[model samples]
Target chain A: MINAPSPTQSPSTTVPGRLETRGASRSAATLAFAWRTALRIKYVPEQLVDVVAVPLVFTVMFTYLLGGALAGSPSSYLHSLLPGTLVMTLVLLTTFTGTGLRSDLSSGVHDRFQSLPVWRPAPLVGALVGDLGRYLLASSIVFGLGLAMGFRPDGGVGGALAALGLVLVFAHALSWVWIVVGISVRNVSAVNAINIGVQLPLTMASNVFVDPATMPGWLRPIIENNPISFVVTATRGLMHGEAQLSEVLWVLAIAGALLVVFVPLSLYKYRTHRS
Target chain B: MTHPVIHSQGLKKRYGNHKALDGLNLEVPSGGVYALLGPNGAGKTTAVRVLSTLVPPDGGAAHVLGYDLVRDAHTVRSKIALTGQYASVDIDLTGQENLVLIGRLLGLGRAGARRRATEVLERFSLTDAAARQVRTYSGGMRRRLDLAASLIKPPQLLFLDEPTTGLDPRSRIELWTLVRQLVSDGTSVLLTTQYLDEADQLADRIGVLNSGRMVADGTADELKASVGGGSLQVRLLDHEQRDTAAQLLGSQLKAQPHLPPDPAVVEIPVIGSEAANDALTQLHHAGIDIISFSLGQPTLDEVFLSLTGHPTATEELA
Candidate 1:
């Protein structure tokens, strides 16, 4: 049973009814929530498995299994395989954010957040910002594994860093789409199902693992025009120091369009749905 | 006159043909606990949500803390906190971290937030488990933390929706004590509960909600008295003697004697001590052996039954 605060240990100065006025600006609070989300990974260390161990395993397995037939050697295959794996790994991790948001809704945390005096979209935006850490960790592991396995980037350190920045921006923008799905879906499983359903098709039909020209004629258009293809090709070009402006612009345009459509859509759905 | 902390008129909300709240009105004064007692689906939670500015009512106006609910929702939100039916603290965060996060969101600086979190943790006796994630805390501990979080910047009014619904006896008593402490410090609380005894224990005034309407509202004694003066419960030694004793008591009291599911007991409504005495003498003269007899004021359940034509869902479940 709870007891009254003893006079000797009373901390009346910080009690309720004393403090007035909002404490932090909307953006600052959003950032604070983002920081809190990232901090949760510290307690649930298993969250790192998707970003760290999965990337290492995928890179090693793919490089060893297909490298001999496709690129003549494992080390040679990593030049192309690493960037594709990075895109696949980062994209897959975004589903976790959607599922996380769905669970937050189910568990009533979303209601608590909505009732607070903070910015309405802070929770959603903060979640996206927090997820950037996972994307960064996964990218670094893929790149580092490639380097350790005798893969080198001709685009030098600056080019490699730029490619990373582009991938992070793209992943961040793509998360808004998932956030919209998260808000609209009925359950966490549905969110995961929809996200995986959309992501696998986008990734496989793109020029990630194999050359678009080698694919059958009917499948060539999808492989050539796919947005993931644009991102992957841009990343490869940047990391190889032979960057293409058209492909980079295409990736940027797709990211901008996704943000423009989904951010407001998510906020609108969040406002309308009491649950 | 000073405005009440919460005032609503003709509050109406509907969910696709189901009227959660219909033409309801409420007035809650400052600095005391006002309990809204009702069964499930009686619109208690809906009323709380509307007053707290979480759900907008379709056809009513409300002022919470003197701010119009619709026009100045941000102001209302800043002045009120709601601890809902479910524990709303983040399960992934430690108890201390949950408080700190809410504090920072409420506009406190990092250091100020940490200091406030520490104070709340200590006040709620959660300092020992402050570093553990909320998922690991027991139900009582989680509920205490939920209440503590609502007090991070205590508002003038607090809304607790079924705050002790699933707690054990000891935890329920502890929460009742904490609510009393909060009320003593001048926070007006509007609570909803199905526990009749809970309302009897904590509320300065109680409102009985039935099917989207305020069926009755008064202090516990007043509401109980409204049902009738009192009730006399008679337990006969022989189960076979129940019908004759009930017949004699019913005619003497000029009221129906209620036969409960138990075969050995009969309950009679009495207007006063004189009525009870007349019935007792009548039973003795009829050679009815009474093992035990007691006269008591009507309970809230009886009041609810008289008003709503059915026992409260909690009583039925019990």
Candidate 2:
């Protein structure tokens, strides 16, 4: 899938050169890494499978299976379900950041990167940026499928796009926590195990599936305080046109807290990682 | 004289209880290959890792390319590259993509990166495999691509940790030639290898490492001369008396004897500072009978054996 632009021919084989270019700027380095992460999609098509299937399966399942009992009907329930499912989809996708980072940390490529003349945090940040494309794919799938299933939104396309942007931000912030996990874990399998372990409770226990009012009394407060709840509630509000200020602030606050806490923690763990 | 490419003082690193580097000091002058010759587990890789800024040292410090190792690490990183033992290119990426990625990181524009990648592929004879994922490449192919990635923009200094390990004879020869060309182009290299001939052929100077520290350092001829004369291989008729004979030769001759898995044979390196005949006489006086003894020639092995008291790891290099 890769094509070298205007491939050149060397007349004679010689040694490696006096450098033809200067050192890359930090942004350029990060962008290069992001380009690398994006390129991997070509080789590992299975990643694209998850990107498409998860939102498709969950949207169909939640609307048809649980929607009748919970929200009365499939079309009626999807209005609430579509936004929540998008939140869950993006949130779950965030875990993969850790999975990839864990393997990259163990691989010898990490050594090569560590010894490179680029910005140190470029690889991690660039991977997240590249992953933003996957989030965009998932968002578009949910919206497209939601519209196909006759789930209309009062807030219109701009609102849905705004919600898409919001969830992408949340995904990036949440990914930092996993970055720490990725750096701390001994192996890629451990990252996957923890991802699965945490994903179930984090996505399911939140208001993504059902309203907290329908949940048990003790679980209501627990769900209300969930960070994912803030994200889901804000996403739902943005998609429905009336963006609740409190929910939006809460979402921003939670994302801010995750970044504030985990960004440095992950970078520190990365710097001190015993590779 | 210009500053050395690398200068370190008492660099120390530990892995739990294992001291990977214990007060290791090194100096590599600019513009030539300086070989760190050691057996496996001799801390060669660890030393390279620390010097390349891939790992923070437990204690001590260094100046790589005249930049402070810890304080000015970014500056050090800007001037050096490391090709580790493993073929470290991204296996998931095509060989061409790996080079382009590295080229971009080295500050080339997209078209510049692609052109450089093509040039590098041609130079490394990897044009055929450039479009294939690195994971599909053979070991030699991966190694060449890894080396190509490192050379996208030749840093001021290069750290090659056993760069030719596991390579075939032809590839090894090709790599040696490349290293010479790089050096002639003024890229100082810190190379670590267990092959005596590799060091002799490529190194401007060699450092013998044993147990996380340098035992001797010099040019190939100087290193061989440092061993004094050579090694004394003594065979005993009695296996039970081997320890006694070893102790006799070690103390009396002031040289440690290496037992090379043969229960009845001990090789005592004859350093120039110490006399072997006196030890042989002492062995005879102490009633430790030997079948025969002979002095080995002053090859690179003898030099290593004299300094570290052990031979380099045996490999069937073609």
Candidate whose TM-score is highest = 1
TM-score of chain A, every prediction, order shown: 0.90, 0.90
DockQ of candidate 2, scored on C-alphas against the true complex (2 decimals): 0.38
- Model 1 earns a TM-score of 0.90
Residue pairs clashing, model 2? none
Residue pairs of candidate 1 with colliding backbone atoms = A16-B154, A23-B107, A24-B107
lDDT against the true structure, each candidate: 0.83, 0.83
Off by over 4 Å in 1: A1-18, A51-56, A217-226, B238-263, B268-289
Tell me how candidate 1 scores on lDDT. Answer: 0.83
Scored by DockQ, the top model is: 1
lDDT of 2 by residue, B1-318 (tens): 999988989999999999999889998999899999998899999999899988889999889989988888877877788888888888999999999988888788788889988987886778999999999998777877887787777678988999888898887887786677677767888999999999999999999899999888899998877667677889998889999998888887677777867788998877543477778888898898999988865779777766787767753332
For A1-275, candidate 1 gives per-residue lDDT tens digits of 22434631222223545377654688878887887778776777676674456656867887899887888988788888777777777877787678878888877677677777888778887877888876886677777778888878889998888788888878888888888778788899898677557787777678888888888999899789888988999988888889889878888999999989988888888776666
> Which tens-of-lDDT digit does each residue in B160-223 have in candidate 1?
9999978988888888878887887778899999988999999999988888878888899999
Question: Recovered native contacts in candidate 2, as a fraction?
Answer: 0.60
